[model samples]
Target: MRPADHDELNRLCKGVKKSFVHLETRDSYGTEVELPHMATWRRGEPDDFAWLGWWLEMLRGHRAAGRTCRRARVVSEPVSDYQRWTMSHVGLFTDAGEDIRYVARPRLATVPLPGSGDFYVFDDELVLFLHYTGNGTNLSFEITEDDRTVRTCREAFESVWALAAPLHAYRSE
Candidate 1:
């Protein structure tokens, strides 16, 4: 079946019991929602962070309800302008209750990772793989209830997660 839209990808997170984990491997992200602000950031100009944005608000609510939400981004060294921009907001994400970490791609030479796309594993049951267009545009996603997919992704994510530096220690970005 076709995966859900990005907006619908997180319903499982809310339904999760233990944790909702995200793995991001892209150097950049493209979405109409944040394009303007991202452009302003690249220009080195002040931009609105829109703390009340839906994503952050949702995270806050999840946290308030005692659910743990976390994300790990595998990025390249000397981070791209987009990654750098995202790094600047690490605090915002964490403050909203996400435990964001950064993993250097080069360091994962021997590590097995999710191929092609990123995935979010909810309570170790649902696995949603996110796909993107060549231009970094958000495209689509595929979710699987397959035990093998979920188990393998959770293992890969955990392995990378173990080596990832907490946002505060991840100064390269």
Candidate 2:
């Protein structure tokens, strides 16, 4: 299937009935919406983080509905500047009911991961593989309902999750 746009992806996420699992393997992402904020952080300026309100509300709603939302980030030691900036505000996501974890890249040497870059598995049935440019710009999402693909992604994410530390406990050293 062809790649879908962000609005369509968000719609699919909102329709998730049980769980949402996101696996991020990139150390840096150059998203248009986030770059400006990241720059402000780099400058040591204060950000109220009001821009995250919508996403936070979505997470709160998902939690209220008894749905699970989790993200696992596989990062390198001495994480990239982008990761450092992201970690600084990760508390907001956790507080809003998203479970975010981090796994050091070295720990995954023997682990099997999907050949794709990053992906989101919805309710263990549907998978949305994210495509990105070399510079970390998000391109599009390729979705699939193939059972084998779903199972592989779910297992891979679970394996990674098992080795990850909750953001609060991870020191990133």
The model with the greatest lDDT is 2
Per-candidate TM vs. native?
Answer: 0.90, 0.97
Candidate 1: count of backbone clashes, pairs at least 3 residues apart or interchain: 0
- Deviation from native of the Cα of residue 80 in model 2, angstroms: 0.3
Q: Candidate 1's residue-wise lDDT over 25-113, tens digit each?
A: 98988878677887887788986677447678878888988888988899987788888888877788788888999989998899998
Candidate 1: regions farther than 4 A off: none
C-alpha lDDT of residue 26 in model 2:
97
Deviation from native of the Cα of residue 99 in model 1, angstroms: 0.3
Residue lDDT tens for model 2, 96-149? 999999999999999999889699999998899999999999987898989999
